[model samples]
Target: LYGAHLEGADLSGTHLEWANLSGTHLEGADLGGTHLEGADLGGAYLDGEISFAPAILRGAGARDINLEHIQCETFTEAFGDASVTLPDGYAAGEGKLSHWSPEKLDWENFYEAWRKWQAEQHPDLLPPYYTAED
Candidate 1:
């Protein structure tokens, strides 16, 4: 269904795992309980009543994509491009929003920033490199 216009379609409880719905227009579609794990939604125009939780958006294009309304929190491969707009309190290379690409870093305090970010994003997880000490 690459680039197919399925706007306002009632697709609830459907299993569309790993389907190539790249660039598809899914505005106002009833995607509740729809399984889009490992699906390719690159460059897709998505808006209105939909949830993408637990969906493996690995390597999916994030150009002009906004997840503030969806509240997605999954990470895998390349997820952001130049036009990617993430939710509040989220950066390109942070927890559940790690971008598989080089981005601007606070070179002088990269480590400290990373540590702070980890703590803020995932306080329950262990530190990087499995260090017990903070």
Candidate 2:
């Protein structure tokens, strides 16, 4: 439903996996327990109240999405990963999404900071963040 307007729609538990919701208007839509995994929400206007968990947005594309007025079910629950780029004004702290008004660093810089800290404190474990395994 890309670019569609579904204002005030009761869409709880909808299986919207991989839907192209770019530029869509979902103001006041209920998305509780909705499966939005791998969905593309780029440029979507999402000012509605949503009941979301961190896994709800796993692998979802949310670049430039407007979540300025969105109220999730809980706060500080880790949401997206490195691929899911969050918008400005919102930040992923401790794996959860919250409003952070401080200077932000890109992923590479953040990773480098972590690596530097690891190299200084724990030199033995100063290596790749994860092992290459399939």
- Candidate 2, residue 35: Cα displacement in angstroms equals 0.4
Q: What is the lDDT of residue 52 in candidate 1?
A: 52
C-alpha lDDT values of all predictions: 0.54, 0.51
User: What C-alpha lDDT, on a 0 to 100 scale, does residue 46 get in candidate 1?
Assistant: 71
Per-residue alpha-carbon lDDT of candidate 2 for residues 12-121, written as tens digits (9 for 90 to 100): 88888667787888877777777765565666776646435333644454445445455432322212323333445446543244322123445445344433433454
Give the alpha carbon lDDT tens digit for every residue of 1-134 in model 1. Answer: 98999988878778775566768888777776676544545557777466454444433334445555655565343345324455677666566565422353332243344334435544443222435354
Off by over 4 Å in 1: 53-64, 74-82, 99-134
Which candidate number would show the highest TM-score if scored against the true structure?
1
- How far residue 114's Cα lies from its native spot in candidate 2, in Å, is 22
Best candidate per lDDT, number?
1
TM-score of 2: 0.53
Please state the error at residue 43 of candidate 1 in Å.
1.0
Distance (Å) between predicted and true CA of 55, model 1? 5.4
